[model samples]
Target: MTQTLDITDRTRLRRSHERGHFDRETINAILDAQPMCSVGYVIDMKPYVTPTLQWREGNHVYWHGSSASRALRNSRDAEVCLTVSILDGFVMARSGMHHSVNSRSVMLFGRAFKVEDPAEKHAKLARFVNGLFPGRYEGLREEHAQDLKATTLLGMEIAEGSAKIRTGPPKDEEADYELPIWAGVIPVTTTVGTPEPDPRNLPGVEMPEHIRKFRL
Candidate 1:
């Protein structure tokens, strides 16, 4: 069963109500599928949107950057909107008005906070690397104290958000459907390619299971 989420005032869908999904499962699926997101916030009433990679742990989403990053610095303790999106295909319609792209997207509102504790931040950092490749973090070089100190991690609770999705063929007006036009979905997909080994890798190092089977 698809569970529904209680829509807060900020998450309420205004236009395409039917396409709005507040369910946690649906929203998380979209987030997990995409590794990057854009965070929108304000600095002295000036708006800014930044592109950064994000990861999900349980119900919270986190992102990290250099300690000196202005975007990350201003984002801490600030009300922000985070969004993730995937382009599935292009929908060609008989008319330009109905032409659109099939996509899945999520918008979240929250006040982001910096992960202050070193131990907590370190654990989250490990999770960040492990989330993409299962055991790669343990096999890589150890993080130094200075390295940890130079990076800052920020997290936001997934308490309020909404997912809007569009799929399938384009919807055209009844009259426009009979026109001599070709309309269909030109599918788009993201796939992992063959692994390219580094020339400096140690002799006879075997590719791990995680890397061999990664998708998206």
Candidate 2:
């Protein structure tokens, strides 16, 4: 496989191009770090973007939703844009125009395809669940056929994409740097909190080790 993705007009960076990266390592890192993503597609010539959880396996990324969903329906075999972003901090600059965010983001352009085979879909779904929660999926009840039927899984190869990242302190003009106004970064992070178990859990049932130690 190529070490970097080819930059086409669609994936080319128009501004602040230094922040853009076409290397697979950087792109895959950002994708693995951020599971939340937005998929943009067009329906009836009107654009639509849907927020969903994504998982990457090798050179492809996958997402799922209700089988009857319009977003999933329209996305199948259609060209789409999938993006993932992680805000690292708030950069407070002396001037409003200079204020910005420290973040890592990736934009991918590709044709989305539905996973039509039942066995493959089930395995992929299990991988998704297990990827997030280790062995949790193996302990869960078997999935019903109807449940599988109600779900839709879509995937796209990571063939065309770029990772754009911004980090560190703010960049202010020479004059603005001398101003008395306070300016600095407010770090932001996503943390997993204490797990809240259902009150109706079977008597004497304890929390799973994975639940207590989960991190994202």
Considering every candidate listed, which one attains the maximal lDDT? 2
RMSD of each: 3.9, 4.7
- Best by the TM-score measure: 2
**TM-score, one value per model:** 0.89, 0.90
Q: Write the per-residue lDDT of candidate 2 for residues 1-216, one digit (tens) a residue.
A: 112232435626333233445366788998999899999999989999999999999989999999999999999999999999899889899999989888888888899999989999999999999888899889999999988999999999987777777887888999898899999999899999999999999999899988998888
lDDT of 1 by residue, 1-216 (tens): 112233435636333234545356777998899988999999999999999999999889999999999999999999989999888889899999988888888888889999999999989989988889888889888889988899989999877777767888888999998999999889898877999989998899989988998876
Per-candidate local distance difference test: 0.85, 0.87
Local distance difference test, candidate 1: 0.85
